[model samples]
Target: MDILMGEPEQSLEKEIEADLTIGDLTVHEDRNEVMHFLHPVVYMTNIKGLYKKDDVLETKWTSYITIFRSNVYLSIFGVSVLVSILFVVIARSANRLHRGLDESALVVWLDASWFTLAALAKQGVDYHSQGLSGRFIVVSWWIFAIIMSTAYGANLISQLSVHKEQKPFHNLAELIRSEDYSFGLIEPSITSMIFQNTKSGSVKQAWSVLRERAKTNPEVLDANPANHFKMVDSGKYCYLGSNYYLEAYQGKDCTLKMMDSPVSWQHLAFGMPKGSPLIDEFERTLFILNQIGFVADRRKKWFKTRDPEECRSSASVKPVNFADIQIAFYLLATGTLFSIMSLLSEIVIASTKKR
Candidate 1:
């Protein structure tokens, strides 16, 4: 059997119906009326969104802070303040009970706050609380500090070590909601037919949007996969297609990424005339190939270059560059400048007092 170059599905179907060639197409319920499909050789992930990686990379200075949720930060602050207040109250009471005199309220509060902050930062503090109650609170604070510090340290290391690229939209719903991306799929394909024929849901909604867009811009219904991928690489468009086809393009262009949201699954099989005698033979051959892992081996051989493990090893971890932590340097420099100003002010005040 000679391998022929693929034509448009309509022409390909006609050729198969006329008994000219045996073609491969996704086996769908609608297509079954016109063609006999052999046992599926490839079960493909269908209708996933593809977009540019550069378009979604986290660029904000605040991205580092996203390691901890807002609630976690708030809870930590609240707990630290509560612990400081408890320490101050216990120390003040112990001082009054034992010596009949206590330190100034402001001084005790400052010392307690400093001690609490030191523990949180995993630093040593000179101050030690007196009495059993005060000691118990200190021990409890230490335990809390240990748990929080451990969690924060682990999360921070993971965030810093793994370069996580963000996604602008995770699903068709989000893609529709986002105005930044214009999405389209290869027209005259089963995936496109599924979108156009769906009666409801995000798929239907997305098709409606694309239809309207296509009226103004015919490129929205492009027949060529290359055009869809080109539009995606421009950073303003998203392409939706089968994972098998998209994965090939993604391997060629590392800048492209397929969204985690898969709209459906499609089975790819060889198509022939409705009463073709070769169907049984083809089915049996495919069954043997599937059982012996030949099909899986071919898929791995084709897609191995873009395997997640290899991709992660090649690109995910890099030495943290100065630009990555530029905000930290900015904060350090700002603090140093403020400290110098405060020192100058103190020196001026001392000179004025001498005068």
Candidate 2:
């Protein structure tokens, strides 16, 4: 029996095969570089992404932030519906008071509104004739903008002037512009900022810190902060998280909360290893989260149980002013406009391509 291995007396290190090594990196004999997944999941998340046992694949990084643009506008949609009805009533009353409505006029007005929204949204336009749905789209969009401008102006005045039990939103700008406490956040990077006076730690900042620290303290980046919240518990680290709401300080389990309204907003989503067959699984996770009303229900539960210390600290706050709802409305409108414009641009491109 001839048994052969390393030459007799060869060091154990000689028997080890390294995947990759940089000075002291000393990667294991049979593994690729590993990254710590900092958010909760049913399984391990790989930066290289989960690939076949033998095949290595390059993957695109996708966001795990849930998109809330639709929901914010949905709130406005309900309000818009109500306002539309009120406007219809006001127009009817004005016609009755100023010039009697023949009931026939009311019918024409209703049809016009239909054409208007479709046109404003850049969908085919009101006048289908001359293929001028294109021109009608532009015209309708301007009209809608004028209408929204008027509505926003009027609301601004009311929100500023009317001090009811509901509290006038008169102090938002100052609040957002005011200095407040800062804390850790989870994300590839935080995307929004309230003007400039606040400092909520973001993934970008965290990543920068992580990168700096990695050179001297490499163990942390490999430590999974997602599955375990201890790093942040140590109060020195931030969790690059998938769910922004989890960082809320007002919740029952809100280990952290915004010192002020979020300096930025991020969409919660499961980042996939771009082009992974797990796209279906990722979508399922989003669906399940929404079905669970994870954010909404959590907000309700957290809002009511805010810490007294936090409330007191933030108590001198002027009111739930511009920084909160107003900015939300702005974002909501901006997002809608952006989506509409993108759709229109696509149509124009398609039309041009066809030509």
Candidate 3:
């Protein structure tokens, strides 16, 4: 837009002022198309330097939480199944020890999970369990339980310890809340922090403001097909989205335009609990990401059009269960060998019985 408009990127003062100077921008006809979802993900680029840094920081925090919940290990159903199995094993083991243990001691053997393991061990039978098939099974079961428990415990620790994920925040309101800023954002320019933001350039706060709106509206996501350059200049809602839009829809009628000067110099980082212990390491990773130009690399990927082939072949692609795929593949590969082994075993047993 700056090139077409034949002007370099303007300062915040110039950007806002230009809104009043420029003639009314035509709202692209397609801006009204309703979306099924609010823009869950926002790519920040293209639009002039209207984005606020506070808003970006705030949105990154919000997106971080949403991504955390989607991990398979964090699911309640997955965790609950492991817990239920643990309790069932403990109950069974207690019943096995009931025979050798005294009546009083047996009562204490109830609920022998990690908490009661020590107490149950101390209450062990004074007499050795002899010819105790049930006791043998219980001990073996506990051993197996220990092994499985150790493996899952390792997984849980890994899930928490090394955070490799870094996601973009889509809502800036969350950032304003985190930074404890004086801005309260609502539609059509409702903000209590107006005075404070005006005094100090709260570009972060401004961008976060758009993020909150994006979180609520699908129109912000793919819905912004309009020529929104003038709208942004007017500051109804400051949008900080990716420049991908320019490449995807570069034509005479498209709405996106880039700003010359940075609206605000922002330190974009993955958001988490404030003052987190992982801050240093995470910050280092962020630096590495910047050094390697990871964000720019992602920008390239984000700008690429969604593969039309995938969308076209959607119906043809069977929704195969990952577990079923493995099981079926293995079963087919070993089915003949297993059948031969079973037949041979049955023949040998029959011959032994006849002899």
| Predictions in order: lDDT | 0.70, 0.36, 0.34
The number of clashing residue pairs in each candidate reads 0, 15, 23
TM-score versus the correct structure, for each prediction:
0.67, 0.22, 0.27
Stretches of candidate 1 above 4 Å error?
Answer: 1-23, 55-114, 117-164, 302-305, 313-355
lDDT of 1 by residue, 247-309 (tens): 777875667777888877777666666786777887788889999999889767754446675
Which residue pairs does candidate 1 place in steric collision?
none
Residue 60 CA displacement from its true place in model 2, Å: 16
Better of 1 and 2 by lDDT: 1
After best superposition, candidate 2 residue 223: deviation in angstroms? 27
Among all candidates shown, the one with the greatest TM-score: 1
Candidate 2 residue runs with Cα over 4 Å from true position: 1-9, 12-68, 102-109, 122-355
Q: Note each model's CA RMSD in angstroms.
A: 12.3, 23.3, 20.2
